[model samples]
Target chain A: MIGMTLILKKINQLIVGLIFLYGIYIITHGHLTPGGCFAVGAVIAGAFFLLVLAYGSDILKLRKREEGSSVAESTGIFIFLVLAFTALIIVTRIFFTNYLPKGITGELISSGVIPLYNIAVGIEVAAALFNTFLALYL
Target chain B: MELLLSIILGLMILGAIYALFARDLMSALISCGIVGYGLVICFLLLQAPDLAIVQIVVETITLLIMIAVVLDSSREELKEKKAAEVKLSHFRKWYVMNVILIIVCLVVLLYFFKEVTSTLDPLGKHLTRMSTAYIEYAAEKTGSANLVTGVLFDFRGYDTLGEATILFTAVIGVLTILRVKGKK
Candidate 1:
């Protein structure tokens, strides 16, 4: 795993950023597109996996970041639950209710709490998967 | 599109058979990956892009996990091979029985498939009420343009919540099992 080759390493470095960006794009556009939180999260985790393969586990700072990923995973789920509960409390008084105004279709900010939920789930999935990889690698 | 789907499905069946009979663990894992990707292609051809996206990602992660397990237990696997070979001879009768059972099952399934297809309307004239309702009202009810997302996150939010909880529990279980003693 210690840098497949100089050219491969360089290419991986260049493409990792784009991969992450694409993952984020998919997550954010979940309400409007075919891709959703889980798909985007996996894509982001793929980027991390690629990073690990290119640079080796030691250089990825996996040891130090392992705790961070665990915390992020928990926090993401916590945020999702809180959002669901808030919807219960403030909006429809029913759990998981989509209460916000359904803005015009095809807009970025149209889906009320769906986008937020997607982002939360995306974070949870990405962190959980990356953490699992780190655990297995260790 | 139908031809492409049939090809992919045939390849998936081939991959599954190869994985089942592969002598080495690594090749079996690789063949499993091939089957998983073929399923993803089949999903895409069925016009389920969301399923395809999710399946492809899951397949990749599964491959990585299998590779890690294989690497970790390489020596153990090698050690077990001799014992496995000894047991294989003893299990030959059962293997043959299982193969015959599988062929019988496949033939029965093919017969049922033909029966069902011949009875069904070719034009899909009979849509289920729930699906028709969803198609008609999903955008209006959830305000999401993507009907699948709207249904998953809005109409079926409880189900999604349950799915999330299940995933969380699985991760927690994995972490608990793999946790090193005396290490935080």
Candidate 2:
């Protein structure tokens, strides 16, 4: 059982949602924004870690969380590799070519394969970092 | 901008000087982080946002790991040191001698640095062939307005893939090693 008090809980509750939204925004807008997959992953991981720290401890719950993160991390990386190889298979036999038509730049739905990579990487990073923290902290 | 750069450089220098005088290893480590963060600011001001972001992340992560290690390994070291410090009166003479020695070493290092820097190329003038290509064609080729993101996910995607794989591998390793209940 690890937690602080009412103030931390209240603040975390208010902030965690905003953090998740911001993380998603950063990931989705990675092509035009200052942040990319690495930043988004770290931000998302930080949000979840804050949420976990505020809640009272349960070893079983933490175990389940860790397991879930592991699965998510594996899936994220698998998607990344699969996407990369898909370009290789169907297109000009290039490993990381932009097979999908690159839409108008600076738009929400532009940047051919980058947004997908950003999403996949964000999942992997957020999961991996959160899992690392749980493993070490517990 | 020059004023800001000088101010940050001065801050970094002060942090280094403070580290020399810090009584505890933790404080010294934190002062060292101050220098790294100063460089982060420098990177941002120099239009190198990619370098700045990477430096900030690496600095923070490394600082966390190091603090954890220091907390774990430094408990008994103080006990041994207190045992060695029997007479404060005797220690004061040696402390002055150490200060003189440190000052001498810093002066020598600064002189060497001054000479070395004089021979280097000017700032922002030197651009490598790869970076030139990125600056020109990254947005067009990758369709990413953010040049850093363009280079990261498009040009050097293999590097990003390797980095993600390495992070995944490290997490898996940590989980395996830190399992609470496992088969014998």
TM-score of each: 0.85, 0.80
* Runs off by more than 4 Å, candidate 1: A1-8, A64-66, B23-26, B68-126, B182-184
Off by over 4 Å in 2: B16-33, B50-77, B82-120, B182-184
lDDT by residue (B1-184, candidate 1, tens digit) is 7788788888988999998887788998999998999988888777889999999988988898788678767723345777898898878859988899999999999999999989887643655798889999888888899888888888888888887888788888888877654244
Clashing pairs in 2: none
Candidate 1's DockQ is 0.71
What digit string (tens of lDDT, one per residue) describes model 2 on residues A9-66?
8998899899799888888888897878887788788777677667744633774534
Q: What is the DockQ of each candidate?
A: 0.71, 0.63
Q: Relative to the true structure, how large is the alpha-carbon lDDT of every model?
A: 0.84, 0.82
Given candidate 2, what's the lDDT at residue A95?
91
Report the Cα lDDT for residue B113, model 2: 93
Native-referenced Cα lDDT, model 2: 0.82
Leading candidate by DockQ: 1
Q: Which candidate should be chosen as best, given lDDT against the real structure?
A: 1
lDDT of 1 at B88: 89
